[model samples]
Target: MNNEVNLETYEEKKLRLIAILQQHSAPEIRLAKNTSNLFRDRKNISGPGLNVKSFNRVIRIVPEEGFAEVEGMTPYVDLVEECLKYNVMPPVVPQLKSITIGGAVTGIGIESSSFKYGLVHETLQEMDILLADGSSLTCSPHNEHKRLFFGFPNSYGTLGYALKLKIRVVPVKPFVHLTHIRHRDAISYFADLDNHCKQHIDFIDGTIFGPGEYYLTVGKFTESAPYTSDYTYKNIYYRSIRERESDYLHVGDYIWRWDTDWFWCSEYFLGQNPIVRRLLGPKRLNSVTYTKLMHLNRKYNLTHYFNTLLGYHSEAVIQDVEIPLKHCPEYLDFYFNTIKFTPVWVCPIRPLNKNARFPLYPLDPETLYVNFGFWNVIKSRKQTEPGYYNRMVEKKVRDLDGMKSLYSDAYYSAEQFWEIYNQEEYFKLKNRYDPRGRFKDLYAKCVQHG
Candidate 1:
């Protein structure tokens, strides 16, 4: 459970953060949090950070009401642990253990449950935001700050920093029953996926093995399981999907199944091998540890040097974009013929609140969208310009009328970026909430890397 928030201490910390921000008049404010799940590195953004690290705590969980009040910096792992004690969990828990609730809402968070409950921000009930002016205000759908409440999801801390958040939680059972349905054709596969979403399912996500192989995993909460398979170490979760028709996992383990392997990215560090797994143990075999090692590799340019020595032009293509469900097959076809990568993670998400439109990250309220996530380095014998592959992705997504999550590398021109992410509304919100421009605008922070 980590630590529970104290009533008085939360107030003290809020006042401290406000005073700190007031004392430091720098316009480029960022949170002084310890962990991050962001993929892209900031180039030169520098300013004194608000020390929000102490705000990581679960405030309270009301099981009967199916909601939990938590500090913005509380990680999903800690939030889940505390909620599970009451036999409930957040409606949509992001796969990563280190992602903070604030980070998830601001960036983007989606999991298997997203098909039913929508994305992480869509599940939020209320938020307490610390505006750039160092004033705190509570916002909800029916509150006076309703515009900020809806617009804050994709703001990435530009509008304000969420000091506390309340999210919807659902009851959980002892186990989860998973049924893996395999499909060979993309059209029929997506059709079946949309069909399954109509059912009263607890979780739905797909894994694309290749052009010829696809798997739709449907999970349901159950009271018991005959036996549960472990993928925390040694065994891998993705490989098991193709090898089995049905599987069982303890509820907690199922929520975190993809995290143990970082959705099959652990092989880069040899964490998948049995011997390596034994040496690293469970504690070290997580995204937090892997991210640290990745930083070291970046510091030393280990992968870069190796790729250069091999005479290959490399581009890191790590992105997540959601295309309309009807156009998913077309998206998949382009992906197979172009930025080819195997085992793409797909999760379906539609607005849980159809009447509520989040202008910053707009989606057709009636349309179902499937998020395609592929993270890997793309290399070729021939050389190309920077963002060569990512630009192709941005163009494709634009042509398809899809939305891209800005947590990773984005290669959009200012005009193109604004056109896709509602520039008019963003400026209006900025002028209203942060007229002084105390924080970087979405374009500078995301596209220009500040």
Candidate 2:
């Protein structure tokens, strides 16, 4: 089977898929290896999926044109390394290095640079997609397939399978000069972030450790630096900045800096023991590496077992809520008073373009929004019910006219989900592209009303 799969070329893969689709009523399409991890419980709803992992390749780089065309399964790490040789990179590389171009494009991908570039999909120049009927088309922002292109992001592969993507890349320096600015309140932190976004900063994000305590971090790309620390080899940027300070990071290091400790979440397990900390360090136990290794441990499924046991005492509620800037203070108070999660990530992102047809895009295009990432372990029984806290947070976000990241577990009914998103537009695209319902709808798979 492996040999036959290897012999099949890209065209052959599409032909085989068309044959399979004709035989079956609906077929799942696996664009990349382990892409199922993006879904909860690693579930794929479509019947007998078509695997396109072999298509992982970097086709070409047009440095002069400021764009790179890569196969859908191409990982961000591979794409970034190739682009770095030409001193250019995707404007918004997702924080995780293992994330693929297809996943990032189909799903929403954001980073510190999001404040300027919007989401990863906003930087896409064009994409080659295989539709449900086994037909292929190249799509762009202002072309014949503009509707599909605009509605692709946050769709989670319900529209089509991304075969090839031409994404916008920007020139970069060798290092990034980072400054950690401390703020005692949400108002001041956002005020400072607003100022920096107006400047020529390359990256911007913040961490809210507790109520009224925040650290707004900003970075600028530079040709050279006097001092530098490689995050892949050293401590995470957030932990290293115990006090207000400045530092420099190699371009690659700066891009995947959060991968070291998975944005400091790994510390919960690896930092508990001194000997283990000395032996493995946070880098080895990095989220991506750790998850890959755990997937290899077949005997016990260590990652699931460990996390499940940990939840017995203290459950971890990890989610990202994008709230309008005007209601940020109210949301923050509710978050701290009700949810009480710690080590929250605060990122300011521009509203999606009014012309963007993606239903999940923020509704209020006139307002600036902040993504509050609540990743904390809670022990309280009141907050530990199956979906109690999730429902609570979801309702609060809806009340504020905000949207929660669908990548995380959502506890909204189909009606509630559509209420927050542009349901009419979504159904229109779904009907046109996937009329047979061959692809799994995002709402059915991700949102849990029960």
Candidate 3:
């Protein structure tokens, strides 16, 4: 159960990994302590030498080029603070501060501004990767190793381990001029979201609190802070909107605002009483701390049992599906009328490069997408198990030509997954780069089974 690996220089780590591979078969690449809940049941194979977490360092910033180069293990919070000194930030900062740049690049990470910038991988200009054989190479979108670069996203580190990355950053003002618009139904909510995207708003996202009730938030970077709220100390945007009509927030505050409540899920444990929340402080219950504690104490299993007794379902039921713009209303109807999960989150994202090696689901570059996040509890039915609901949603996403984020459980069969993703090209590259099968197979590790 020892999880620690001796720290070493980048070159020394690479040589050590090569030496280890020569002796043992393939070992698991353990980065952060947090595991993606979707792959909770999957066990990592033993026999590794290098741990990239030791490489956590912010190398430097190039203000003229509008980019920053940092080691793969650098956390989002650290990156943001460094970038803020130059008045520039990553185009889409994932909601959680603990998410690492390497994790986000390999996995999918999005935010309010994703509607314009696509996923975190798309914002990456170049990356330094260590292949399975321990060779290092720098790749970019137009480089000779372009296939490895584009196919790397959604690969789950099977292709290679990211050592360093140069990511695109944008200049920002001191604060965000926030506006809240209420919508009575899915049709109007989406319509307004479309308008906001067309107008090129700096940031946009909404919450479907209940059937026919939604709140659409749009923000623009500005130096003027007519009225600013203490979102960090007082309340998260989701809760604060209930009391105030509108208010501004420090740019950093607005970016990680969802961290306070982990997108309103913390209320389940902390209680809905504002007085209690003030006394306890939201930082104590932030998602990173909560997840680490659950893992350390094995309390997650206890929570699952308690949920079943209380008629609630497992945390695995939480999921996010990205649907094409045209099919958003249809998916919303399915979510509200059929599944009955409340407070669904909605955010828009543009399509990635069509010719890219790894094809994002619903790989229509001409079309936009609406990410529908259902992060709530569910009740099991008599004829169906709790997993039945998730599989049904997965089928619907496939039917609508959409893609479900890999961060959640995927119920697709080997054949079904191939149909949804470009499996042939991915496997071809995997064979070329990791012929020994040292890394975890994406399907075997992530695909769920009964």
Clashes of each: 0, 0, 0
Which candidate should be chosen as best, given TM-score against the real structure? 1
Better of 1 and 3 by TM-score: 1
Candidate 3: residue pairs that collide:
none
Clashes of 2: 0
Superposed on all Cα atoms, the candidates' RMSDs to the truth, in angstroms, are 1.6, 4.4, 4.4
**lDDT of model number 3:** 0.74
- The residue-by-residue lDDT of candidate 3 on 1-450, one tens digit each, is 011222245557556655754554445453333333333444544444455555566667766788887778788888898888888999989888888888888878889898788888888999988876667788898888888888888777778888888898889999988788888877888888888988968999888888778888888998888777775545566876555557788998888788767777766665346786777676664667545654543435666677668776554566888898888888888877667867778888885556554453335667788888876556553435646878889989888988887766677888988767678777887898888776667787567421
Point out where model 3 deviates above 4 Å.
1-39, 44-50, 271-285, 293-300, 308-315, 352-357, 360-362, 381-383, 448-450
Clashing pairs in 1: none
Model 3 poorest ten-residue lDDT run: 1-10
lDDT of 1 by residue, 51-78 (tens): 8899998988888878888999998999
The C-alpha TM-scores of every prediction are 0.97, 0.88, 0.89
With a 3 Å backbone cut-off (N, CA, C), the pairs that clash in candidate 2 are none
